[model samples]
Target: MLGDSAYKLALETKRTQAHLPMYNEALVHHLCRETRHIMGELETLLQSLETIRDEPDADTRSVAAQLAVKHATVKRNKRCLLAYQAQRLRFLQNVFWQVGGVPEEIKPQLSPAELDFFSGYALAVNTYKAPFIDLDLTVSDLPPKDLYIEVRVLQDCGEVQLENGSLLLSKNSQHHVKRTDVDHLVSRGLLQHIDG
Candidate 1:
């Protein structure tokens, strides 16, 4: 699903075209495909390790060294995959921000890598300040007022305080809340926005 979304977005981006300097669409596709490939490899490695672990002690001794090597490979690849995803997220964030603005629900859910990339992006754009024209308009703008949103909670969110009252978001529960209050939750992936 993620791979399909990434590819679709890339194709749409290339077809529509960008009027300003932005992240490369084709590169996004490549990174997404690479991440998916690494994830598949990691899954296979983990399953193999599980199989080895389930064997009897006597049988496992012979391949203990091999299992250790495979474990290390899996760890390394997992880190690589995370980094690639972070990079991809950063690019997408910028792309969406530039065109209109990153939806409020996505801003706070940025991973460490994506946050770091955002920091660098912020600094780079800040340096381009204009003396008269004020060319520093890179930051994303805010959404409109009065939005009605429906979200399905992916995990327990404890109690969230709102202006009107507090609500507990239980796992797998669906609720209607204002976008302002739940945007952060959605960005954290704790809640999935369900469009009517």
Candidate 2:
């Protein structure tokens, strides 16, 4: 039993280490896809607005104005996504550093925003005399979740073996679980919280 437990720990550690790279890549890809989709929708709206703006009808003019607002909103959303992507990449970089550097091929190219984030992170850690640089600046101030909720899995998560039984998270699978139990998966876009 002891040997079995030891082997499980070792295997779980290995999976955790390997999962980071996959998670990081998945995050970047998701962000990029969302940004591109928003940009495409914005472009289409702009193109349609151009025609409406040239029309003499007042209704068309109002439509154009609405499209303009939508365009601006999409631009703002894209910027927010970009900012989030940078922050998330920086956080992953710190995590990689904490456990030793990631594999060269899997390492993402650092952006100026990421570099700036790291600079600020280092400064804050130094100023506070932090023992190790493993702080997750994102969502650090959020309140704890006390409610359990239902979530739908968007991807296969393999078999999560727990103390009593194992949970199978195949694609499109739904499960009722605590927020803390699926927080990481939701953050990684693998699971989605279903509002009741």
Candidate 3:
């Protein structure tokens, strides 16, 4: 019962490996409450142990065993909480790298703290990339076979300025552009690459 909430959080984290699940605020609170309760119990046991430290008839071993168990429970709960949060942070970082920013659909599912982290991460990445104006770190790892690729606009993005010239992007319109120019848009789902 003491570690049930933490166990549930661990299971939830494992179940949603492919995508992010909604933040489980209620379960987290419950786990925190459980930890606090255990800590209080632990403190009382400690005081009792201190009082019975020199008493010959007192069963000090039993109190010491209880304290150990409670201490272990507290450590387990802390670990589970940290693991759940760390997993979520890693997932958010991956999503940021994939999309250049958090997608609108995923925004509603993130906690406020996560959203703040995302914003901060985006800023940090941009700062890290500031010097490499010609390179995009968010693009695919595989090297491109061609410099020019045809892309179909998935939505009206208005006019976009490129290295060579400006192009009017309208829904259902196709344009042959440099791969580097549209990689970000493609990742954002505003355009689709056409294979030749």
Candidate 4:
């Protein structure tokens, strides 16, 4: 029962393989409280052990064993918390690179700290790619077979400027545009690619 909260956090992390689950704020808070309580108990045990240091009795051994268990529990809880956060951060980073930015649907599920991290990461990536304005580093490395591709607008994107001209993307409207021109839109989920 002492480490049940940490175990639950581990299980929740394990369940999130492909997509991010909603932030478990309640469980995380509970685990933190549990760790604090255990730490207080550990401190009390330490003082008791010190008081009875010269006695060398069975009670001293019992208190020492309890202190060891409490210390182990604290370590386990800390590890679980760190692992869960690390996994979530890694997933967020992948989403940033794959989607070109964080989607609105995924934003609600992220914690405030995570949202800040995502924003900072996006800014860093944009800054890194600033010099190569003509090239899209986010697109696939393989060469395209065709210069242009067909895409259907899933949402209204207003007017998007291209090298030659601009196109008005309306909901449910289809267009034949250069693949490079709409690759960012496709990654953002505003347009869907169609094989022509």
Index of the highest-TM-score prediction = 3
- The sequence of per-residue lDDT tens digits that candidate 1 reaches over residues 32-106 is 565666567657755676787876763555455654654554454445445545456556555544533344555
Give candidate 2 regions above 4 Å deviation.
1-140, 144-146, 161-165
Candidate 2 clash figure, as a count: 0
Where does candidate 1 stray beyond 4 Å?
A: 1-146
Q: Is candidate 2 or candidate 3 better by TM-score?
A: 3
Candidate order, TM-score descending: 3, 4, 2, 1
lDDT of 4 by residue, 1-196 (tens): 8899999999999999788999999999999999999999999999888888867553677888898999999999999999999999999988876788888989899999999999998899899999987978787667888999999999999999987899999999999999999888887789999986
Task: Give the alpha carbon lDDT tens digit for every residue of 1-196 in model 2.
Answer: 2123223333433455433333334444554565566567768877777776667863565656666765665565455455545445655565534433333544454554554665676566555656645444332247765557788989899987533467889999898876655666676668888887
For model 1 the local lDDT of residue 15 reads: 48
Candidate RMSDs in order? 19.2, 19.7, 2.1, 3.0
Pairing residues by index, what is the TM-score of model 4?
0.78
* TM-score, predicted candidate 2 vs. hidden true structure: 0.33
Assess candidate 3 and give its lDDT.
0.91
Tell me the TM-score of each prediction against the true structure: 0.33, 0.33, 0.87, 0.78
lDDT (Cα) of model 4: 0.91
Q: Which residue pairs come into collision in candidate 4? A: none
